[model samples]
Target: MTEEARPESPDIPAAEFEDSDLLRPIVESGVGFRVTSSLLLLVLLTGWVIFGRQLLYGLGVTGLNQPVAWGFYIVNFVFFIGISHAGTLISAILRLSQAEWRRPITRMAEVITVVVLAIGAFHPVLDLGRPDRALNIFTAGRLQSPLLWDVSSISAYFMASTVYLYIPMIPDIAILRDRGVWPHWFYTFLAWGWEGTPRQHAVLERAVSILMVLVIPIAVSVHTVISYIFAMTLQPGWHSTIFGPYFVVGAIFSGIAALMMVMIVLRRVFHLERYLKQVHFDYLSRLLLIMSLLWFYFTFSEYLTAFFGNEPSEMRVFFYKVSGPYAPFFWAMVVTNFLIPVLILSFRRTRTIPGIFIASLSVVIGMWLERLNIVVPSLANPRLPLPTGYYIPGLVEWVMFAGGIATFILGFVIFARFFPLISVWEIEEGRRLSVAETTERLEGYLPDPLPSAPGQPVSEGG
Candidate 1:
């Protein structure tokens, strides 16, 4: 074996470290974990209590009136779904690009996609409050409605993302199974007889590659269809050809921000400093910055087109956004979504972990407001002009919203307790194979050394 074949870089974490360290979370999370988890679960239960109240009192418990039938629930539906885009979409893109750094981050991203997606999927049903009737769409399902398209697409995405999240996790689960972790039977079942043989490894890689290619379009379509829920309508502000791309971009933008926040929290909580290094943060921050710019451009083009068109209905909604009751929310959205992120993430001096967290927090809040603005204004200031109705989400909606967020956190906590947030096998694989693979690929790019200048110098070490 050549001397160079040995893994040399000190910074390259050892595969054995996976056994010693990464498995710790699965084996034992400290007492603080229990306390915090109990708290999150308690908070999550409160939302159910509020939901029960809504059931008792009826939809009147919400602020939904004639014109503004949507409220915090629908806005949060869009917001949470947007956050869902961060996971599988980014992870798939990075993996397809053959990015080595993606190994540590992809699992978390995919998990976020899966967990938040499940949470988001229930939002529309929550809005309806009749989970039983949600199935009527299937019983009396009409292919004509855009709402039907949303149901089909989101359901497909959820199933696809869950499978994607699971496929890569099998090897790790097998490792835990072999180690005889407490839930040996569960991991044993999940591992699916994976012995990490050469054939198994190859099959795993092929499956991941195919899924990565497929997931990007599915992720994009999920948010695009969600946008169609509004865009398909002939409402004043909601109707636009750009809404599809706009929603897709906004989804990814918010998704990246949400991922950053998750990354930060997981790193701090799990003490994963070795796995999730500062370089990961820097790479992810660059993505966050790019998405921020794209979001700003979309928002600009959207409003600019409206301002120039000056249609009475569009203008009423647009002007209301700029200077009416919603003005504060609109400008705040701009500042949080664009200004704060741009200012913090643009410069390395302030792009610390905390900085990214603050920026991510801003983007999350801003994106919620952005969704609210998109949903409310056009409905409140209807083109038909039947006494503009304003929406203020009542106590029930606020409790439910808090519960939804708590559910996300609690889900992550529960997931971490059960599994390693990082893809330990993928990291080891990269350390082992990526060097040789990258060198071979780079060699293919060189022009065969120019035939040694026609043999003028056939020097041995030239």
Candidate 2:
């Protein structure tokens, strides 16, 4: 029988435990990596060309016009930022809850949040017609402007998430240092002279714990402030007290879906079936299902309020979503976001890898549609219709979208090549923790170890 088929025994070396699950996937995702990297580079070069054109010729190259100022770029901005929320939520929230399974997964989720947040945060600058005047937002920055709120909250969230990703990474960096494969100076620089001493470990643990506790609210606030940017405007479809929670929930919903997709791709690419087991997929599927329901509830409430209140601006935007040019996208969002995920994830068999993959893919696409719906239709149906605004995305927008996604892939690809994508130290830590947690749970279930044969005096400890 294969090693996997053999029953696990105590004889298994503890050293074998270290983050092998994470390494397995990285090892397996082979040569095609170079191809993906090359493609990403080409895309990045193209994006630069487009960006240069925009910079030189101005925002005139894009379909963006007056009133409908924000278009695909902002949609993607919100979409990507929402995706960033998932990593910290998974890594920090689950870590705080003492979920033993979090060890192998937290690193990937945390990296996703940091990288995607970087991409998302840059988008507003891209949206600015006068990016050269960008510092003016800060120099003459109005504390009252929702735009300024976005700049502040996004910057804070980025800093917090980056620190969160770096803290746990120190141990792994120490591992790499020990491996002795480096530019000497480069690894030395990043390793921060880590010795992994007991004091160092203790300090690192304390830092991570504090950051995890701190990041949740910051993550929530970042998205809330993002929603406030829209809601603070009295514009149709943008104004709603519920917008804050709605954006946060939607951010998490999309973030989790994006996380599932990343995990799936990495698993397939890296061949980490052992570490990223079916159990992880199953749990993720259930979470996705829950988020789907939550999203549906929020979407329903938001729309129902708009429909029933008969407010002209809100109703105009709502009907435009349902029956206007955006009708197909809106309904498609319903099907993909709600119907598909709910049906597939609800079934046990459908919680498997392929099923969850379908659900996650659908959710990602649907969430993008939702962002587009929120942005465009409202702009299209202005309070004072200037010939019913039309947003025809030009080449610049497409290049930017492609660049953002390419950058995401590029970052992961580079990470996979340089360092083990999985947290080696954490995985080992997890196995020990998992066994301990399981034993504790099982002890609770079992009859007390027969209070040691009267005065036979059971050895106090196992």
Question: What's the lDDT for all of these models?
Answer: 0.87, 0.84
TM-score of each: 0.94, 0.90
lDDT of 2 by residue, 73-131 (tens): 89999999999998997789889987777766888898899889999999988888788
Give candidate 2's whole-model lDDT: 0.84
Report the C-alpha displacement of residue 380, candidate 2, in angstroms: 1.4
Going through the candidates in order, what is the number of backbone clashes in each? 0, 6
Off by over 4 Å in 1: 1-19, 452-462
lDDT of 1 by residue, 311-356 (tens): 9999999988999999999999999999999999999999999999
Clashing pairs in 1: none
